[model samples]
Structures are given as C-alpha cells and as structure tokens.
Target: MADIGAAIATRMDVLPITRTHRRATVAVGLGLFFEFYEVFLAGVLSSVLVKEFALSKAALPPLLASTFVGMFLGALLLGRLADRFGRRGAFLLNLGFYSVFSLLGAFSPNAVMLLVTRFFAGLGLGAEPPLADTYLTDLLPARHRGRFIALAYTLAFCGVPVVGFLAKGITEGKILGIPGWRWMFVLGALGAVVVFALRRGLPESPRWLQAVGRTEEADRVVAAFEAEAGITEQKPAAAAPVNEPAVPPRALLRPPYRRRTGMMVVFHLLQTFGYYGFGTLVPLVLTAKGYPVSQSLLFTAVTYLGYPLGSALSLPVVERFERKFLVIGTGLAMAVFGIAFGYSGSMALVLVFGFLYTATSNVFSNAFHIYQAEIFPTSVRSTAASGTYSLSRLATAAMPFVLVPLLEGAGPNWLFVTVAAAMVVVAVDVAALGPRTTGRALEAVNTDGAPVTAPERAPRQ
Candidate 1:
C-alpha cells in the first residue's frame, strides 16, 4: 500500500512536457528573443544609425544609456507589479507594451526621439526575462527543471546570432528601397504579432496562483496540465514544507530569503558586468584590433556560436554538480579564457579563446539561471529574480559608457584582466557564501523546510 501510494504520488508530480507547455515555452522564448535583439542590435547597427542621423560618438552614450535607464525602472517597478498581478496578466501587458513601442521606435525622426522610444520599449522588455524564468521553472518537475531552463536559454541565445545575421544582411542589402537598419525595427515590430499569438495559449503558473491564495485557479491549471499529460489525480506526495509565508515581495526580504537575495544580487552584478562587457563590446574590440567592420562582425558571429552549444551541453551536467561550485568554477574559467582572448594577437588564437570564453560563460549562466529561480518560493520568486537580475542589467547598462572608456584607456588586455579579476572575486564569494541547490525542489531552498541560512563568505585569497 505504501509503495502504491508512492507510485501514485510520483505520477501526480511528474507532469510531462505537454503540447501546451511546449507552445508556451516557444512563445516565451520568442518574446525573449525580441528583448535581447533590441539590446544586442545596437552594437551591430550603431555605425549605420550614426551615419543615417549624422550622430557623433558623443551622442551615442546617452542614447544607449537611455534604454538602460528604462530597463532599470521597468524591472524594479514591473517586477513588483508581476508579483501583485498574475504572471499571465503581467506577461501579456509587458508584451503588448514593448511590441507597440518598438514599432513606434521604427518611425523615430531623429536620435533623441529614437532614444526615448527605445527607453520605453526597454521598460516593457525588462519584465519578461525574469518572469519567464519563474513561470517555466514552476511548470517543470524538479528533476527536469535545470534542463528546461537550459533549453529555454538555448533558444533565447539564438537571438544573438540572428540579430547579427539580420543586421549584416539588412544593413548591406536594401529591401523595398528602405535601408537595412530601418528593416531591423520593422522585424522587431513583427515580433509583437508572435507574442500575441503565443499568449493566447499559454497558461498562468499554477504555483503562482496558489501562492496568491487562488488555490482553485491553481488546481484548474494543474488539472489542465495533468489531462494534457494523461495523468489521473492523486494526493500530492509529502515533501518537506517550505517556511516562506505566502506573501509577495515582503516574503523575499524575510529571514532565509533575505540572505539568498543579498547573495544573488552580488553574484549577478559581477557576472553581468563580465558578460555584457565582452558581449556588447566584442565588435569594438575587434575593430580596435584593426579588423574591418565586416571581419569584426564575422568574428562576433563565430564567437557566439559557442553560446547555445555550451548551454545545450550544460543541461545534463546541471543536475550533477553542486550549483554553487559549478557557477564559481565556470566563472573562473570564463575569466581565464577572457584574458587569453584579449592578449592573443593571432586571429586563430583569438577565435579559440573567444569560443572558450563564450562556452564557459554560458555554462556559468545556465547554472545560475536555474539556481536563482530555485532559491525562492513561488510567492516571491519572480520578484527576487527580477530584482537581482535588474542589478545585472543596470551594471550592463553602464558597461558601454563607463567600462568601454576604461577598456580604451587601459587597453583590451587590461580590460580582460579586470574582468578576470572580477570573476575571481565573484567566484570566491559565491563558493564561500552560496548554498547548494541542485536536485532540490523549489520549496526545499526556501525557509519552509530548513530555515535558510547564509553560507560563510569566502576567505580572501
């Protein structure tokens, strides 16, 4: 009887990736693609936009910084909104807001107007990434959650290469007698149509509904999932109870979560600084090395090819390693390879190092992406992840203007070294201060079971 009961419980918990879930994932993935496309396209299209508007380098920083400012406000404000409102509502609203604004941005008459539009568009885009992470994590079984997160990110990173190819083709080729840079925004507008279509079928997160005291809605959503997966209802298995209260943002700041939140903020901030510093500025670095625009783009494309591959390969290993150690080790590897790429004069060496850098970064990224979502309860998961991740974006926002200047003044080698050193600092802090989260249910990491305790800080090396 005990064995039979356990079997029934297992059946209830392990929902298959049904068609609805798959469709929802794809839709969310596409929405994320557009968001990243906006952030990344700026680098590739900067030269074209500048020429079209007769804008100088001095004008570009403020224009770019404007979007970051919007993103910062959006993530902090809208993240809380998501926690208060339903994830589905927040998702649809954000999608509509960004899509429409992005379309309008395509028609901007001058740099100033473009900046303002992009900034507002960025505000909408900011809400999707963390919300998507939380929603998807809640849908999957604990065993498969890491792989699902990696796969979602894999699909999302495809945007990097897609944006590059699109920028290259449209900027070089005229379509309907309109310049390619203009077509980029046109495509961005089309992304809204996709978002609308996808949202029609996507379900609200069941865990989220339960947290907000909408237990009936949560049960109905889970019922739909069960029916789709061809499973019959059974009592949920007895698991360790989580200690978190079913409140939204406030829960994140309470006892166990407060430590988790603080650690994540530090981890994400350092990682973002390194990730965007290289990602956004790779073309610039190549250009500085005397590579022509075409060659630099080609190199950037080649370098990014490793991102999805790394993420794909990480899916299996994600479950096997301690999340904290995996993140720390991968970060150290990213730093090592990043510095090597900066110092290498030979193109072959540069490409090799670049590939390794992207690969290691993605490994670290996929691990942390899964880690952050698992650390909080459903009530505050999105809020915590978004708030922490927004810090990274804010850090990333400063990279182009502040870090780029530092790179130019100190040279690329020094820039790489600085990033490497930052990663070491992050890795040690994480290793010493972070907790193991692998193979655990989301509830396990919260205060419900064992009161979450802060790990000791890494001793200064």
Candidate 2:
C-alpha cells in the first residue's frame, strides 16, 4: 500500500500543468484568502477599537489575544482532521466553522463578547493555512511545486492589503450605519462562505487515500487528473502491496523525525515574535510612537502592499534555490529591515523600511510553508505541521501581553529590536538544522533520499 502511495505520487509529479491543477490551486487559495483576512483584521480593528469603544490599557490585551488563543487550540487539536478524515472534508469543515463565529463577532455589543466570538472563529481559522499547505503540496508536481504554492499564496495574501486599506478608509467611520470594524468582519465571513461553497468541488488527496489503503479511490482521482492533463501514457503496474507500518501520533517525537521536529518547534516559537509580532502590531507600534490613529492605519495599509507583491515576486524564483536557504536569508533581511523601520522617524523612511520588511517577510513565509509541508510524510503531514504551527499561535496569542508593555515602557525602537533578535535566532535555527527541499518529491524528502518500500508480509494461513 505504501509503494502504491509512492507510485501515485510519481504519477502526480509527472502530469503536465492543466486547468485541473489551476482549479485546485484556486479552490484552495480562496480559503487562504479569507483566512488571512480574518487573521490580520485583528490588527487593523484593534487600532480602532481602542478609540471607538474607549478601551483602556487593561482591556485591550484580551481583545487582541482572543482570536490567537483560539487558533492555538484549533491548530493543536483540530489539524489532524486532514490526516484522519481527508483534505476535502477538512477544508469545508474549517471554513464553515470559522465564518459563523466571525459573523457573530461582528455583532458583539462589547469588547469582551467580541473577543469571545473571535476566539471561536480562531479555532477554525487556525487550521486553514496548514490545511492549504498540505493539500497543495500533495496535489502539485515536484518540478513546479514551490512556484504554485507561492502563486496560491500570492492570491491569498491580497487579503492583507485589502484589510489594511479597508480599515484605513472606513475603520474610523461607518458603512450603512454599521461600524467599519464590524463591516470588516462581515466582509471576511462572507468571503469565507463563498470559498466554502467552492471548495466542495475539490477532490480528495490521492496521496492520502493511497496511504490509508483506499487504492481504488486514489486510482480514480489520479486517473481523472491524468485525463484532465491529456496524458495518454501510463506507468507500469505497481507490484503487490505490503501492509504499511502504522505511523503513531507520537512518531514525530522519535529519531529521524525528532531532530526535524525540534528544529521546527524552536523555529516556530521564536519566529512568531518576528512574523505576527510586527505584522499584527504595526498599527499599535506606530500609534505608540506618537502617530495619530489615522496616520498609523495609512502606514499599515501601504506597508501591507508588500505581502502580495512579495508572493508574486517569489513565483519566478521559488523553485530556483534551496528553500531552507531562502528561509535563512529572508529571516536575516527581516531583522535588518525591522530594526530600520523602528529607527526611522520620517514618514518616507518608515514606509520604505516597513515595506521592505513586509515584503521579505512574505517571501520568508512562502519558503518556510513550502519547506515544512514537503519535509513530513503524508501519513502525518497535517498533524506534524499543525502541531508545530500551534506553538507559533500560542506565542502570537501571548504577544500582546508581552509586546504591549515592551512598547509602552521601552518604546518602538527596543520593541522592533526585540523582533530583530528573534529573527536572528530563527536564521540560526534553520541554518544549523533545516534540510533542502526545493524541487524534491515529498516522499523522497521525508525518507532521506528515496521512497521507502517495506517488504510484503505473507498472508495469514
């Protein structure tokens, strides 16, 4: 069965680019579009909530941390749905779960109620990016996998600038008599609802189906893909299958995987301070630096242009270099730009340094997401990725508590310096331990050099 799974991967890896592939990428990418919208909305909205609702210092952290706390639990507890139930089902379930809570969050009468709903929404939102990564990784061929993943994210990351600009234009005012922040949540929820309906058209992951011994279903899905790609040639039949060894949930804690897991765990924990730290805190950081709320929102919106631009720029080169090196190189760049962003007192320098940091961060994001999805075996891909990703969520949830005071007491300069230091650690962690993953099949990367096929066991007498 494992050999059959490997063969299915080979078939997928060789198919030419076709509409079927593009359709899958778009379907998965749309979910991510709203997922990012929901995630970044907290930052934009928080800037307004403090003024709109007259929130005090004591009341703000809970509101800021609420959704991230939910995300931590969701990623930690629910990420295995893809590994256990199948990717297509998990896609529908998560989007639907989050959208409802996001809608409710829009109607909350108070900050406390809003955060509660945001937390529930976070539960579903947390699983989305990991699921998108694993699903796309399974579907695309090795030759252009990095490019497609970066492409999908290019579409998805448009949400960041959209939210940034939306907040800038409306967050301090109203639309149809409703508060702009509430409108932002409603917009994200509605977009997610649309993506949920579209995702139903997706096919289950053939690699996952084969890994779980559903070879017939896997064959049908791959056959449909081949037909869509107009391939007439077929590989020779696979040999008789052997039983696949069970991958325990604890498998990530053992030897070959253990070292990889440790590196990822450390990377994720520290990386949060740089990624989400600067990302979600930008508005507040500018505000704390004595800028008005309006100016802060404007800067945030302009800076967010880097996300989609970076993802688009990465498409041409995503597969050209080792992904680990991209991760390391970009992390160092982020540290440099982030520190410069903090020191710039002039608006032009602020926008320039901020845009540079945001752009490089997206490239870093693209490289690491593609890297992590390819490193783990299909049997535990979502679980391991989610488990490691949850730590980042956990750290992000704690950022308000930690970063808020640092911003207040030490000022934006030291705060961004702290962000720079975290990125330095991330660069070190990856440089020391991360593996090369560009242009390699998931199976080969996970198994060290080539696909592993266990010998067949004799039937019971």
Candidate 3:
C-alpha cells in the first residue's frame, strides 16, 4: 500500500506542467469563466430584460431557475458520459454544445426562447466546472494541487469583473446599435471559440487513461509529462494486489467518507443559499433599495472583488489546516459577518461587510472543491463532485423565486437572518462530521477500509 501510494505520488509529481499543460489550464479556466459569465450576466441585465419583455418580478425566477434545472440534468447526464467515455471527449462535446447554444441565446426573440436557450446553455456550463476540476486535479502534482486548484478558481472568477465591467460599459454606452444586454450572450459565445481552439491542443488526462485500462497510453502520457519536467528515471507501476475488492460508491456512505460527503453537502447547501441569494439578487436588492443602475454595477463589482481577495489570502491557510476545520471556521465567520451586513445602512459598511463575507465564504468554497474531489476515487470523482455540486445549484436556483418572496414580504434583514442561521447550522454539521483531508493522496483517501497512510508532499518542480 505504501509503495503504491508513493508510486502514484511520484508519477503525479514528476509530470511537468509544461507550456502545453499551462495552456490547457488556461483554456479550461477560460471555459469556466465564460460559464460563470453567462450565469451572472442575468444579474446585471435583469432590469433591462424585465422592462423590455414587459415582465413582472415573478417572471425572473423561473427564467433563472430554468438554467439550473438544465444544469442539474447536464451534470448528472454528462458526468456519467465522462466516466464512461473519456474526459477529453466529454469536454469537447460539452464545449461545443455550450458554444452553439450561447450564440443562439443572443438571437432569442422572446422571454420563452431566451429561457430555453439559457437552460441549454446552462447544461453545457454545468458539465465544465466539475469536469475541469477533475481534469486539472488529475494533471497537476499533489503538492501543488491546492494552489493550482486555487489558481483555476481565481481565473474562473475573473469573469465576474469582466462581466461586470463589460455590462457596465456596454449598457452605459450602446455598441453597434445592438442592445448592450444581448452582447453578454454574444461575447460569451465568442469566448467559447477561444476555449474550443485551445482545447484542440490538450492531451487526455493520464489518470483517466489508467482508469479505462489503457495502461500503455497512460504511461506514454505520463512519460511525456516526465520528459517535459526533465525527470528521467520513472517509478515502476504498482502490480494490482490479489483479491482487492472493488470499492463501490455506497462505501462513500460508510465510515469516514460518509461523514465527509454529508458535511460537504450541508455546507454547500447553506453557502449556496447565501451566495446565490445575495449574488443573483444583488441588482434586484439594490434596485429595491433605490441604488441607480451604474451604482449597482459598481457596487456589484466592488463586492465580487472579495472572491479573488479571499482566495489569495486563504491559499496559505488552506495548506496548513485540515479542510474540514477550515470550512467550519470560515463558514462561522461568514455567518457572523453576514448578519452585520444585513443590519448596516451605510454604503461603506455594506461594502466592507460584503468584502469580508465574500472572503470568508470563498475560503470554504475553494477548500470544499479540493476536499470533495479528493475524497472520492478517480473512477467516480467527477460523478460525485458534479452530482453534489448540482445540489448547490438546485438550492441556488430555488432561492431567487422562493427566497425573494420572503424577502419582499418580510424585508431584507429577515431574509439575511434566515440565511445566516442556516450557515450556523452548516458550520455545526461540518465541525462535527467532516473528515481531515489536508495533505492526502486522492487514491488513498477512499471510504473503503483500505488502510491508508497520511498523504505525502509532492516534490517541488
């Protein structure tokens, strides 16, 4: 077992993340950014769409909810496809699906058409995050996995500012006689073109190769990575031990991993309620509070800065602490700060609270992505993450329609208070049940009764 672990780690470590890998990372990152851009643009363009289509506030939720419904189906369906087919094949097909639908979204003539297009676009978007997370995690060395994952998320969020800035600029100044709001979908489609081009050069993940019984192809891919990194002597592949029982997904519901998955799902559920509630409804909330469009966009931009800022500050801590503890601590902090945010009237206080809330919440966000993917075996990693992540999306999709009514009836403070309380519950669950996965190998962190060692650090490149 020790030798097997070492061999896997060595294989992961020796593979150089060369220029090609870097480009692959960038392509995948850009793909994620565009996915987010499509989702978030609705927040920026809500009022415009509402007015242009002569729709009421009640109409907004269903439009947004449709996307997540599609995403749920996509993740479940496409995730299984990735598992059965291959990562590269699944990724290319999904990207093409997204690109075509996004472009068509720009041509939607009515609310119904737009909603349908967005839903399909979301299906394509849904597959990318978990797929990208799985692909990137498999490609990088274990020691650098956390940082690389952080970088991917950071770059993925670059779309927040880009969407905000573009929406602000174009909406404020109409371009090419086209409605600025429509350009959001148009530009998102254009971005997909870049993703498509770069993806053509990406090699298949070596880990995926090994899983599908293509051992020679896996060796060559790993060897290429090793050669790029200048590591000549390769570690011998581990012989399969006799009578090793196949670990089923049901095992994840047993001892160590059961607790881990439950904690993660609960944490994500609460966080999604808060995050999607606040994030998706920002423009509507701001408009209700009497902020102008430009100011709303500006404030949204300022608030989202917290995501990247939080990611940067939390990277060091992520490496130091057990992922479960980090999630609990950050989640508790977010709950406290979120309440303060709900009560504050001053704009400066709101922005301050927003920044702090985003920072703390994202620490949990970044950690969980790495933690969840690590907890499962490679055979079902994408399935687990995608399926689990889709639950958060489902929660988020429901929030706008369900929570918005409560906010309107009871007021913003009550709405936030409810969300904060949920966060508190999540924090407790995670603290009690979450497993330690700070420095662990992906293969050894299984729920099955495999006697595993503490994950070792990968050699620095």
Q: Enumerate clash totals for all models, in the order shown.
A: 4, 0, 0
Q: For model 3, what is the C-alpha lDDT against the true structure? A: 0.73
The per-residue C-alpha lDDT of model 3 at residue 256 equals 54
Give a tens-digit lDDT track for model 2, residues 283-346.
Answer: 9888887889889999999999999998887887788888999999999999999999999999
lDDT of each: 0.75, 0.85, 0.73
Clashing pairs in 1: 170-180, 242-448, 243-447, 243-448
Tell me how far candidate 1 lies from the true structure as C-alpha RMSD in angstroms.
6.3
How well is each residue in 1-461 modelled by candidate 3, as lDDT tens digits?
Answer: 43433354347644546766677777887888887787677777777788778878779888878777777778877877776777887788878888888889888899999999988988887777888888877777655677777777777777776777777778765678877877888888888888888888888877766665666777777767767767667544332211122344576577655766676677667778766677677666666666787887888778877777787776787767777788778877877887787776878987898778877777877787777777666666777777777787778778877778977887777777887888889878877776666655555555354434433332433
TM-score of each: 0.91, 0.95, 0.91
What is the alpha-carbon lDDT for the whole of candidate 1? 0.75
RMSD of each: 6.3, 4.7, 3.2
Q: Which stretches of candidate 1 lie over 4 Å from their true place?
A: 1-12, 235-244, 448-461
- Tens digits of lDDT, candidate 1, 96-150: 8787878888889999899998889888888778887887777766666777777
* Evaluation by TM-score, superior candidate among 2 and 3: 2
